[model samples]
Structure formats: structure tokens, C-alpha cells
Target: MVEFDLVAPRSADEAFAALRAAAPDGAAVLAGGTDLLPDVDEGRQRPRVVVSLRHLPWRTLDWAGPSLTIGSTLPLRALEQDPDLVRRFPGLAEAIRDVGSVALRHRATLGGNVVRAAPTSDLVPVLLALDAEVEIVGPRGTRRLPVDRFVRASRRVDLGPEELVRAVWFPEARPSAYRWQRVRPANDISQVAVAAACSPADRRWRIAVGGVAPRPVRIPSAAEALGAGAPTAAAVARAARAAADAVAFPTDRRASADYRRHLVATLVERVVDAVVRAEGFPR
Candidate 1:
């Protein structure tokens, strides 16, 4: 592993300044370090200076009217068991539960996960499904970006040199449900992952698929197929097809593209069925 200097800032301003000092040359901001450590050790990433944000002031969760402001430093474990969060956004809570092991969850922060932007991130699909917004602090000032636009294929964002993920604000959903499934390859990462969410208030739903492409992605065409009017076997199949076609799955050691595509359809169906049952409704 490469050796680098570590800096811990007590406040956001100090952190921003430290980042600015190192920004022109590309500095890395460290959070819980769960995602960064592996890459650095494996030679996928190297940094001259690692600015640790764990001691910064971005660790509190606050309420904002119909929305809840989740701090960037808040751990996934806290998200998993927060009663208010569970009741208001069950889909998010469920997503948090599936992030990793209990110990990992206790130290994995939301900001870190989103910033990592891995294709298989457990929370990405659910956050995108809810049409959430991202909070970022950059040199220009803090700005809010939509969760969808925040996602890019290169696992990079528009964040400026002095920027860091500050928080995420999402409105309290009005009764929602979500479904998730993962096909774990025997000796590798997941072959495929499927997730879906439904909001009864608008009678609208979203379906997101991960682990089949370069990024955890949203399939607009397939989501449209799963309309709010009524559920049927035919509708399910059509939606599944769109969802599969929307992705450009590739053949990898985990699974062949064909296998992943087939599983995507099956998982989509399974999730849709589970969600319907969860809502005390029929397909």
C-alpha cells in the first residue's frame, strides 16, 4: 500500500480549505474509509493527501418540515433502525438494511456510499426511485443536485475541488414499498441486482436495476410499462422486457450477459409480486 498524509478538519470550512489546498492536484476526502481503503490497498487508487472528514460537523440528522435532512456522516446502521425514517421511508430503510453486514453498516456513511458510486451500491436504486436530491458543498457554495443527474458512468460527479457531500434531503413519502434481490456468483460479486419501489399516493412506481452495467441504473421505458392502473401477468412481462433491454449487460466472470438478462426479468417479476403482496393488494 502507498503511504500518504492524513488531515482531519474539525469544521466544514477547515475541511473545505484543506481540500482547496490540495484540490488543484486532485485530493481525496476520506469518510468512514470503507470504500476507499480497499481500492487504495489494491492499487486502484492512490492519494498524496487524505483529508479525513470524520471529525467534521456533518454528522447530525435534522428534520425539515415534510423532509428529513440526513447528514453525510450518518451511518447506514442508524438509517436502518430509525423509527421515524422507517415509518416515513420504508424503502430507504430497507435499502440501508441490505448495504452489508451489521458491523460494516454501523460504519458506512451515506455520503461515502453515494460518492463511491459503485454499480452495486444498495442505496442508489432506492434513492433514485424516490426522486431524491443530493446536497453538496463546493467552492462556489453549497448546491443541490438531483440524485439521477448526480449519477454518471465514470463514477465521477460535478463536485468541485473544495466540495464534499454534505447531506441528502428527501420528502417524507406517503406510504411506499420496495423490493430487492441479488444473484451472488459463487466466486465473485453479484451477477445481478434488481430493485423496485411504489408510492400509493401517486399510484406511481419506479424500478431500478444494478449490478448488470457500469452503474446502478434506472430504466425509464420499463418503469413506464409498470403503470399504476392495474397489475397483470402481461404487464409484468412487458415491464420486465423493457427493463432488460434498457441495460447493456456484459459477459463477465460473474455471469454471462444472457444469464444476467434472464435473471433481471425474473427478479423484476419477483419484486413486483412481493411489493403487491406487501401492500395487501393483488397483481
Candidate 2:
């Protein structure tokens, strides 16, 4: 392993200065270090410096009124059991639960997942379904981008070299639903995952699928199928199948593209049934 310096800044501005200094040299951001650390241990993320974002004032700077801002260091486990989140946005909680084992969740942060931009990331589908946005900061300033557009590639994001993720903002507490099913070994990528949700407050709905594509795929038509009116079991099943059919999934070791499509459809339908029913939808 090559030697590297670890820098911890007191604030975002300081962090950006450190990043700028390391830009010509090569430095990487460190949150909970769930994904990057693994690669580093396996000889992948070689950098001259590893900036410990731990020291920055993530709690204060991250909070934005109305829209909830989450720091990059906040644990996934924290999200899984968040009370306000469970009551206000359970769909995201469901997706967070499926991220990994309890231990991994304790160390994995939402910002890391968004910045990492893995196509099959568990949070992507749920966040996209909820229309979450990311706050990116660097030498310039902060800018917000839709989560869906932020994860446009399989393994790359839109962040520049000097950029460091500041926070993720949830503009509204949209009611939604999610389900992820996998037929793979432990710690392996998902075979098929489904997430769906609707904001009863505004009649906005979202249903996104993952595990079968480079990134989470959305089924707007399915969500549109659900107006303020909730559907029955049969209708839910049909919507699920229709959603699976809508996306052009890619094949992977976890499952065949054909099987994944079926999983996406069925799981989306099942989760929709669960969410709508859980929230007291009319039969």
C-alpha cells in the first residue's frame, strides 16, 4: 500500500482549500469510507491524500429549512430507523434497510452512496422515487442537482476533482413504497429491486426499479396509473408487471435479464400493495 496523508478540516471552506491543494496531487473524499475503503484495501483507490470529512461542521452547515439536509457522514443505519423518516417517508427507510447487513449500514452514509454513483445502489431507486437532490460543494460553491441526473453513469458521477459532496436534500416528505428482492450470495449485487411511492399530500407518485440496470430505472407510467385513487390487488399486480416490462434491463451474474424483469414487475406490484395498504388506502 502506498503512503497517503489524511487531512481533516474544521469547515467546508477549509475542506475545499485542502481539496484544491491536493487536486494537482490527487486526493479523495472520505465519509464513512464503506465503498472506497474496500477498494483501497483491495488496491484500487490509490491517492496521495485522503481528506477526513469527519472534522467538518456537517451538522450545522447541512441543515436547510423545509428541505431536510443530510450530511455525508450520517450513517445508513441512522436512516433505517429514523422516526420522523419512518412516519413521513417510509419508502426511503425500506430502501435503506435493504442496503446491506446492519454493520455496513452503521458505517455507510447516504452522501457516499450518491457520490459513488453505483448503478444498482439501493438508495438510488428510493431517492429517485422521492425526487431527492444532492448538494455538491467545491472551490466554487454549492449547487443542487436531481438525484436521477447525478447518477447518470454506472460508476461515475458529475463531481469535479475539487468537489466534495456537502449534503442531500429532500424537498418534501413524499409518501412512497419500495421492495428489493435478490437471489444472490451475501454482499452480492441485487438481482432485482423495486421501489414505489406516492405523495398523498400532492397526488405525486413515483416507482423506480434497480438491480437489473446500470442505474435505478423509473416507471412513471406506473405511478401515473395511480392517481389519488389506490388500486386493488389485481391492479397492483398489473402495474408491477407493466413496470418491469417498461425497462430494458441488463444481465449480470446475479440473475438473467429475463428473470430480473419478472422480479422487477412482481416486486414493484407487491411493494405497492404493501405501501398503499399500510397507509390505509381504500379497497
Candidate 3:
């Protein structure tokens, strides 16, 4: 790995200034560093300067009316163990539980995972299904965007060179479920993952999938079908088939395209069924 300067900023302003000073060679923002450090060690990223957000003031969780705002630097382990978060956003908690091991989760930040934009990121699909929004601070000031659009493609995001993720916001929570297909129960990386959220009262639901494409995507056809009415086994099967057909799976070391397609169908059905049961869908 190349030698680079590491700057630990005590505040957001200092972090922003450091990033500006390091341009256009650019600086990598270090929060948790679970993903960035590995790439840096592998010589895949050679930033001239590394800005650490660990000392910054972005590591708190708060409630904004009906929404929950999670500081970007808040550790995944905190989210996993927060009783309020677990009760309100069970699906998100479940996804975070699947991220690496307990030790890794202790050092991984939710923002870091979203910014990494990897197809296999455990939290991305669940966040998308929950309609989460990301708050970012840059040279221009603060801005917010839907989580689904924040990640543009594999290992790519909408954040500007000097932008730093401040926090993530989730609207009112609803009944939700998540299921992932992995090679083993101990493996954190998923071959296919599905997240579903439902509002049985309104017959509205959302579904998103990851690890089957360049980026996590909402399965609109399946969501539409499930949201139209009660999701019976037949209806769930139909939605799963639609989701399988809609995803563009690519062959990867963990699994083949065909295998991923099958997993997507199966997991979609499983997650939808789980959510339906949790929501007590009418018989």
C-alpha cells in the first residue's frame, strides 16, 4: 500500500476543509473503515490523504417526530442492539445482524456500508425497502436523497468528492422482513437478499433485492402485485417469479447467474411470506 497522510478531524467543518485541501487528488473519508481499509491495503485505493471522521460529532441517534435519524458514524452494532430501533425497524436490525461478524459490526458504520455501494451490502436492500434517505454535507451545504438513488452502481455512489455523509433518516416504520441466501449460515456475504415492508391496513408494500445486479433495486412488479391485496402462497409465488424475471443476475465467484435468479425467486417468496405472517394478513 502507498504511504498517505491521515488526518483526524474533530468536527464536520474540519473534515470538509481537510477534504478540500486534499483535492483534486482527493481524500478518503474514514468512518469505521471496514470497507475502505481493505481496498487501501490491497492497493486498490491510493488516496493522497485519509480524513478520519471517528472524532467528528456525527455518532448519535435521534428521533425527529415520526422519523429516526441515524448519525452516519453510528456503529452497526449499536443499531443492532438499540431496543427502539429493533422494535421499530426489525427488518433493518435483521439485515445489520447479517453484516459480517459481531466484531466487524462493532466497527462498521451504516453510512460506510451505504457509501461502499457494493451489490452484496446487507443493509442497502433493507434500507431501500424501508424508504430511507441519506443526508450528506458537501462544499455546497447539506442535501438529502433517497437511499435507492444514492448508490448509482457497483462500488459507486452519488456523493461528491468532498461530500460526507452526515446521517440517514427513516420514516415511520412498518411491518417488514428480510431473507438472504448465503453459502453457509456463518458466511456474511449473500448470494441473494430480499427485503420487504408492508402496510397491511393500506395494502401497500415495498420490496427490494441486492446481490443480483450492479446495484440493489426495488422489484416493482412484485411489489405492485403484493401491495394490491393479501399475498397468498399463489400470489407470493407469482410475485417471486416476476422478481426473478426482472433482476439482471451476473455470474460471480459466490454463485452463478442462474443460481442467483433461483435464489432471488425463493428468497423473495420467503421474505414476502414472512412479512405477511408478521402483519397477520387476512385468511
CA RMSD of each candidate after superposition: 2.7, 2.6, 1.8
How far does residue 148 in candidate 3 sit from its true spot (Å)?
Answer: 1.3
Best by TM-score: 3
Score candidate 2 by lDDT: 0.76
Off by over 4 Å in 3: 200-202, 279-283
Candidates' TM-scores? 0.89, 0.90, 0.95
* Model 2 worst lDDT window (10 residues): 58-67
Q: Residue by residue across 140-244, what tens digits does model 2's lDDT show?
A: 778889888888777778888888878888886665677767664446567777777776556656888888556787788777766555775666766776786
lDDT of 1 by residue, 203-242 (tens): 6667877775677777877778988834678989999998
- Per-residue CA lDDT of model 3 for 34-143, tens digit only, reads 99998999988888899999897888999876578999999999999998887767789889999888898899999999998887888899998888999999878999
lDDT of 1 at 132: 75
Which RMSD does model 3 reach against the true structure?
Answer: 1.8
- The reply for model 2, stretches above 4 Å from the true place, is 59-67, 184-188, 232-234, 280-283
TM-score-better candidate, 1 vs 3: 3
Steric clash count of candidate 3: 0
Best candidate (score: lDDT) = 3
Candidate 3 Cα deviation (angstroms), residue 168: 0.6
